[model samples]
Target: MMRRNDGCTILHAAVIGKCYSLAIGISESYPDLAGKRNEKGKTALHLLAAKPESFRSGSAYTLRGLGMKSLIPLLILRTIIYCCIPVLYKESQPVNSAEEPSNSASIHKLSRRSSFANYILGFPWLKEIDDARQSHAVAVMLAEKLIRREDWSHYVHTEFKVLEGSQFGISSEKKNRMPDPLIQATRLGIIEVVQEILSVYPEAAYTFDGKGRNILQIAVEEEKWFLYDYLMTSGTNMDRMLSAIDHEGNSIIHLAAHQESPPSTPPGVLEMMWEVLWFKRVQYDSYPYLWHLQNSDGKTAKQVFETNHASLREKAEETVRALANTVLIVSVLIATINFAAIFTVPGGFDQTTGEAIFLKNRRWEFSLLMFYLAGGLFSSLFTMGTLLVIIFLRFETEDFYVSLPCYYVINIISIFYSAVLAIVACCQALIVQKVVITDFRPLVVLFFIYGLMALVLMETSYVIFDYAYHLIRYCLCYRGQES
Candidate 1:
């Protein structure tokens, strides 16, 4: 058939619209249609590569129009079963006669052909490739399809061949090939797609793009944490992956050191904390030589991190200084209040005996007041001392992880103790006033409330202490591991 004015044939339009059935039918009848190009010199593959959305939506509409929507579930189930079937059966088959293909061989070939047919017709590649353009919903689907297809090796090779012929290659190996779909998926941060691609084609993870950046390098450079974490834990050879240097001589650590600014809401302290964690994790995961290795710029990983995170370090320092100052002020206020309360006892002193008027008469109440007052006074003093230490002490990065939480816990306990002391002292003052309480019910209620508040304070303090202890232990363990 003659091409349209825009040089797009019927098959080109169908592929562009993601009408797989129509495109397949047209291609089957006129195989030449697959090679036909549009006015922009883009073949059917180029049209499919335009954007995932165009093909995905078009395929769905086409499927519904053809009343094949119900078959999607069946196709998926068949794909799964087919993928799981052992390939060891292929090895068990007897040698085929050269004169004529054996039934088993024919059946195997037919099954492979049928699966590929289903792959092309069932919208397998399109769904994953398309969703990977924007999301990861169908990544597994794409991976399964690729793994299930007996000709997947040939298929991928042919696709690259077509890409090369189309002049998509820029510089290196231009006459040979271009980046595969898997490389493109990794660059796009479609983590599942990359995972699936690597699962089916493990060697693809090492394949570099035009810039000589592998999947791991791209993940670090793009700051895709999901992909990065997955790559780290997915049982890949960490030593090799980390050791890979890009064209610029930047290793994985160097790329990580170039991480961009964190989100604004988490405060600079957390940002710095995460930065430290990443630095430590990479150091732990990679070889010691990586730390000393210089990039193309002749800067080590530490140097790169320091240069990139200088502003972050400054911001973190400012945040910590502000926090410590605030805590110091609160501690001073609580200490002053507690110290003043010592002299201004709840009851007035006797004129001659020079003792609190209620101390002898209400010895129990006076003892309780003194106990809480002393507790608050000591806790506040301790908090103040800790705050001073925090302000003046030069903490290495690792030390802050252990010290900050402990300091915060002390500060919180001091505030709680002071508040409880103030409440108890006020109640004691009322008792000293000798207000008429013939009912006795009010006294019982006050005592119950005070007891409940004490219980709550004790429970909260215990929880904070437990949490801080575990955190410090973890920090110590982590530091030991690093050493």
Candidate 2:
């Protein structure tokens, strides 16, 4: 019943209503909503067919007080729904609304339509259902027509695949491999269909398709703006989707960042940018941070698009690289400022001045310092005490601009705080051990241990390689560096 302009046509809705309400032997399709009890087993078709008074063929009806004549073909096909109809039947009539199937073929086509819908909905069907596959073919043909007309959502809702091996089949994947429903729905701008499928098979949305293309990647490729819109506005944010790679190993942001320009054919690609970026999809791939992301060939989407479409590739590359440079500078500056306060570093911080002017920044210095120090201290302590047992806590990825692996940051910060508490801890341990006399032997061993600390520092730096690279790049960035 999905219409061209709107979603479902009144024609389809009426029929579906009948099929749903009436179990068998009647036109499953009708618009008599009063008799249509979606919640009740009293189907609209049953209500219509099981009229208080019986109607017969060739009857003048009102003339002798006889009921209405029979014209609705589906209503009449109910005598022997399974045996009477072949599931593969269809009409030769040029696709017209009036030209419904004469018998089992027509019923089969209708049955196919319903079955396909149920399959996509993850519902089981009865083995006795007839002419179901043929109806699926007709539905697919209709969806294809609608898609050509750019009524993507309508085509999408159909699932049009019960006709998989039928005469009008278009299942692109091999018999064993089918296109991802999420991708199919996305490519066709079928938001409702995608959502329904997701409800039935929520895992499918996250599955990468045959091309290694995730739903978001496919949506961007097809430029299904509305699908993109629905994805973001419906609470699926940019950061989450863009971060994921399709089976083909492409991220949606990578697709957007790499596309030379919006494909000339579809306007959806460029138009949906507003929705994606606004939702924090981490869309700007114009940075070196993302440059390292690789597809199956070890080339990123940027490399692929640039290779395929050279004219505008430089523009994309420049934008991404420049942005990455800026971020590098910002991160380095922040880390530098932080490092300055923590250690008596030679390059950036003046140790004597830092101590002398600790509170010289005056004004709210005392209160602000108290707040940050005390608060940061307690919060850090509490967090460590509560979270240390769970190692994965350090690895949790936040979607905020920082997108830092909190597990790493929290644990690293906690380690530093513990190092600072060494003096107190040592005092307590000393009280427990009662070893006050000079421990030259332990000190000598400790010196050897300190030598290993250098390697530990190097390993720790490597552990944060990606993050550290960004910081260092930011600090070192200069305008228009050659090569």
Candidate 3:
């Protein structure tokens, strides 16, 4: 209504707080001035005219007492603060009129064939030919690369099969046969397309082809190291290609270890392979260490060849040990030092006793002693324990009782060390720690370090391997869906 009166004063209208709500209700009776605006479509002058009229007519508003009428502008200001801005906010946001991607049927359909096919076909490829002709291997690799280009497509189709074969120079019995194309692709390291295909064909990803090579083994043979590592790691089979033979009973590691030169399985290739199976700590059919793993000929990976190959095996062993055990080594050392240490290290001899009881010795020994102090040593319990046990064990013979005190003292010291180590490793990760079967010591720190490293290796292997496997399966799924 004030708007209808051509008032410009927003402050006066706001200061008279309750009037705004009343104004809102009375507003519908008149034309919406906001809509029926001036020729310039502006209301800038409306506010100025309204304020002074309110101020001038309010002379009787001087109550000289306590009534809400005296506090109109303050109340209006409060009301504007508490009410006005909030109301405006509610009207400002854009409404979500667009629907969500919600059809289960369409989702399932997309995961089926058409999308997979489209992904496979849609991906662009590099057309460079490999130089070394010794490898029909290269052509096979290219063919696989071309085939993998559409991996996100959910199903296998004739065109994909044709592309797969044409890329590799290998023909197949049927148009939609998946093996040869993927085999080539796996060999080629065509990751993008492969991932798309496996998203749809998860099960098929694990299947083996005519040469008795699963796509994984084929990948290894084709020296597609990433695929080999992925297959070894995928958690599908920790032992997947460990024992897989390439027409001769040679395992994948065997082939890798047997590469005729210095860096063994190709410098960069080993790294890719390692990433795939880095965390995988599969118990070898024989021993845990690759240096100790033997082939069908009963030769360890280290023993695969006599000279340079042996060096390669040694290097692999070194790498494995270093990666898997570094954490455990450091932890164990810290834990060990944190574990043992009762009497003070002899900085000098005991002059009063006149006997050379040089107790604590080296840095490692001192480190071993540190564990108990860190644990807020309940050593007093050990002292009390020694006294009690000493009494019980040596009541009849006091001479034997002397030894009993000594025994009790030794045991108390030992137990404190044991408990501290248990606390550190267990407290750290909160894993249900395996019972440490071996005896604990400073040197044992190395064992703990090695174990942790192996655990990391296996775990890392598990994650990446599983991811690659999914990618492999996703590629298939995408392929099928595309088809």
Candidate 4:
């Protein structure tokens, strides 16, 4: 019952079903079963490498709807807060010198290394084992769990033997070979799993995948910032890792230049920022000469970036245009409304004095109305001026970092000022009209409610614009693919 015709054992079935508890139970009772092979000469470990069905297939639409529900409110809140505050960058602290190890400490380190080596060389299944194609996957998973439970030094020196041929007497050319687990994990962006494998087997960092790409290259290509940052500080040989060139003669910088389209929901600005961040990080990490090094196509890293990001740059320009137009139109409308409100004061003019009726009797209401009108007019004018400058200015890729943020800030401020004006106008009207409310507290609460409604309106407009942009972009992409 434990072994099947296709060489699948009960352990294989358990692993396939992701029933770790059952696999452990079977392994404990039949320890020898760990060495058992199915008819195809594959072990239970191989089954673990098969891809799992994505939960997205069933729940993607629901999740997307939920995300959209929360996105606008969060963005509105974040935008308001961000405009109100400035971010500060902190200087990095210098590293302190470490004291030299004593003779006893040296001896202990040596003993630990020896013990780890012995543990690896002594493991029967790990040594002289053939047909353990997927064994590395199991080893990596176990190693991660062990690292979590135990100390890093315990497995720092462990190693495994690389077997050479098909174990089941099948043609060598037809054998299903497994790539190094570290490379596989790195490609998959499994940071914890890769970290465990590399910590115990530092030499694995030097291993290349089938594409002749190293860990750093994979991290750069995949945009796995967490993994890339980890490797940088992981105390490995940095020079070798940074200097690696893949089969296509593409360096780390070259790989970083190739941008994939971001998920449809992320704003274009954020996607551009991420691409810029990746380029800067890779540039900082690699040798300065890497910038000039050309790939097989005779294009420098900078050239590759320019070529790849051409479409993105165009899209960004389009977004900038749309944003400018939207802000300008909204500003004009607000300015027009405020202009009209100024003439039609909340309180009618005094028949004898030829001034506002509330000017002398209700000075506070008059003052609030004046302040609201003035603020709204000033904000609208400022927004229009900014939009004019943006529309006339030439925005290259380098300019986006500074200019785009400024535009967004101005837009938020304009919306906020307009919202405040609306709230103030509402409150002043209620106060001057002698509404049923005696307590001003309800008016204040109503002001807040009006402000919130304004924010919701502004945010809803942004969401609509973003979705429209995405829909158009998707249609274009689909058409391009079809063509």
**Winning model by lDDT:** 4
lDDT tens string, model 2, 1-483?
Answer: 224333333433444443322222132222232232333322222222222121111112122111122322322233334234344433333343544422211222323546664464343333324334333333333322222222113112323234356321222222213223345446555454455455444445544555655576676766554455566545543443555554445555456544422222112211122222322232332233444577656776546644644433333334333433443344344334333333431123236674423334332433343333343344445444434333222321121113332333454555444333332333323332334443565455445454555345434433233333433453354232111
Clashes by residue pair, model 4: 7-38, 7-39
**Candidate 1 per-residue C-alpha lDDT over 1-483 given as tens digits, one digit per residue, 9 for 90 to 100:** 888899999877876665544454455456556566677655554444444344222233222122223343444444454343322111123365544323112111112435664466458754443333322122233233323231223223222222244222211212214325555555555554566557776765556666666677777766555467789778886656776666566767787787553232154755665565556555555666677788778898888988887777778777877887997888788778778888888777999999998788888767777776777788778878877876886655664345665675777766666666666665655655655353576568667777777656544344335345435544565532131
- The residue-level lDDT of candidate 4 at 395 comes to 68
- In order of appearance, the predictions have TM-scores of 0.53, 0.27, 0.24, 0.64
Flag regions of model 1 displaced more than 4 Å: 1-198, 219-229, 261-267, 349-369, 394-483
RMSD of each candidate relative to the true structure: 14.6, 24.2, 29.8, 15.9
lDDT of 2: 0.38
Which candidate would rank higher by TM-score, 1 or 4?
A: 4
Candidate 1 versus the native: TM-score?
A: 0.53
Q: How well is each residue in 26-127 modelled by candidate 3, as lDDT tens digits? A: 222221332223332222212212222222111122221112233334433433332221111011122343242121011001123355544653444201
Superposition TM-score, candidate 4 onto the true structure: 0.64
lDDT of each: 0.57, 0.38, 0.35, 0.59
lDDT of 4 by residue, 243-353 (tens): 766667788899999895323335565466557656755776677777788887888898999899887877877777777888789889888888788888866898887
Enumerate residue pairs that collide in model 1.
Answer: none
Error of 3 at 236 (Å): 3.6
Model 3 stretches with alpha carbons more than 4 Å out: 1-179, 207-211, 219-229, 232-246, 260-298, 305-483
Ranking the candidates on lDDT from highest down gives 4, 1, 2, 3
The better-scoring model by TM-score among 3 and 4 is 4
